[model samples]
Target: MKSLRLYGKQDLRYEEADNPVIENTDDVIVKVKAVGICGSDISRYKKLGPYVEGMVFGHEFAGEVTEVGSGVEGIRPGDRVAACPTFYCGECESCKKGELSRCEKLTVIGARHPGAYAEYVKLPAENILPLPDNVDYDTAAMVEPSSVVAHGFYRTSIKPGAEVAIMGCGSIGLLAVQWAKIFGAKKVYAIDIDDAKLEVAKEVGADVLINSMEKPAHEQIMDHTNGSGVDLAVESAGSPITSAQVFALPKKGGEVVFMGIPYADINIERFYFEKIVRSELTVLGSWNAISSPFPGKEWTSSVHYMSTGQINVKPMISHRLQLSEGPETFDNLINRKGSYVKVLFYPELD
Candidate 1:
């Protein structure tokens, strides 16, 4: 099998690797059809993450089942599916209370176990989810990222007819734009410095596009909202600047959800920090896309909406390559060489 492995920071190799096999009674092996690169993958590539040297490196994907263990039921070969790569220690306090995302030992496949960057990967039967007939391999590969955006929105108290401002236009931010509409927002604002991403956001149902390079994002948001600001604001840029700037985009007593992980220290200015106190805003932090009964409604709703043509990921996909291109792709991504949005890999492509 050919795979891209992480040797160290800025070191990704495309080489032959061992294929995964069913190791437990409930284990299952999947032949990778499509997989997408995540923002976290880029971050990890920039600086070493919690991964062993030369481990297969990827997570978001959808594929066909090739083998199943003796205890596996309701799942068999030839099933088209997407998987929840996350794992949780069920005995932890948070897990005992049905808060799986908050489990003390929560983790995903790519960090420790082998990932879906190659032709074959393995997971427990419970992590496998069958795809609907209408969902294709490309869309199914995006289910994990869509579920992540859905999880963040589910943590908010957004009501029908509410206005939303999403402070980013990356892949996660693009998904947030569509999720805002599905949550019944009257108007959805997409903010970013890049016109290309903002255009994609518009194509995916963003009602308004604001290029923050012209002015501060909140100022433009206020002008659009008649000086009132939005009912809900989402920070999905994962940049320290946007993380603080997001506080000022919501209305008084409105909600703010932090879905992006700022890997550096955040220093909020007085103007932005005061919004949290003077406006009595509700600030929330959302993590992985899992909940109570294992993978939860985030996964189910993401696939359902994708099947219905609501959560569209096609316009967000900027690059499509084979597994052999993994090394150079990661290099170009981190070196800022191309107009990359969302890159997907077709393992079957030679």
Candidate 2:
């Protein structure tokens, strides 16, 4: 078996590794088919710490079940599936309330344990979900990240015919564009620093594309909305600047949802901070997509949308590479070297 392991910051090595087996009676082993390189994965690869060498770190993955444990039911060795990757203790107060993301004993795959960036990975049977027969492995793997965007919508009060603005056009932000349109936004304004990403944003569903680097997003949205601003603003960039922009982009009495995780402390300007109070803006913070129902309704709805062709994940895919290209892909992602949108990995390829 071959796997990519992180030795240090920006240090990834593809080497031979032991094959995973069924570890628990409720666990199943999956042959890795497809997995995605997430933006956070690139950030962690460049950060100073939080590095764990010898770990296969990839949570957005899907594959065929190669082995099923004795206690597993309804799923077999040949079932094609994608996993939630959220491991939680059912005894925790948060878990008892069905908020697994807030569970005190939550362990996310790829972050805390070995993930699917290998030939095979072991997971609890309950976490494994069967993909529809029509969905391909690449799209099935995307359900994990897509669910994150879906959960972002759940935290908002966006209604049909409302004007929406999404800060940042990264993977999550671009997906947010699609979900906003699907969930009933009359118009969507996508803001990003990259022109290439803005183009993709337009293709997905963005009615207005504003290059924040070239001009202020708030200014553009105000001009387009006749100075009224958007009804909903979603902050998905997770930066101090983008977060502040989201705060100022909404109209009076509008709602702002922060979905991005800020890497550094954000200092909001006094004027921008006052906008929340003066405009009576509803400010909300959304963490990892967990609701009052375990894995949450977002996951189920994401799968349903993709399986039914109501949402398209193919256009978001920028590159598909073999596991051997893991190191190169990480480098490309860090440097922003290519016009890449989403990168997928196929472990079966050499």
Worst 10 residues of 1 by lDDT: 46-55
Worst 10 residues of 2 by lDDT: 46-55
* Prediction 1 TM-score vs. true: 0.99
Query: Each candidate's lDDT (Cα)?
Result: 0.93, 0.84
Write the residue-wise lDDT of candidate 2 on 119-213 in tens digits.
89888887888889888988888887788888878878888999999999888898889899888999999999988889899988799999987
Clashes of each: 0, 0
lDDT of model 2 at position 322: 94
For residue 103, model 1's alpha carbon misses the true position, in angstroms, by 0.9
Please give, for residues 77-99, the per-residue lDDT of candidate 1 as tens digits.
99999999998989989999999
Per-candidate alpha-carbon RMSD to the true structure: 0.8, 1.6
User: Residue 92, candidate 1: how far off, in angstroms?
Assistant: 0.7
Cα deviation at 234, candidate 2, in Å, is 0.9
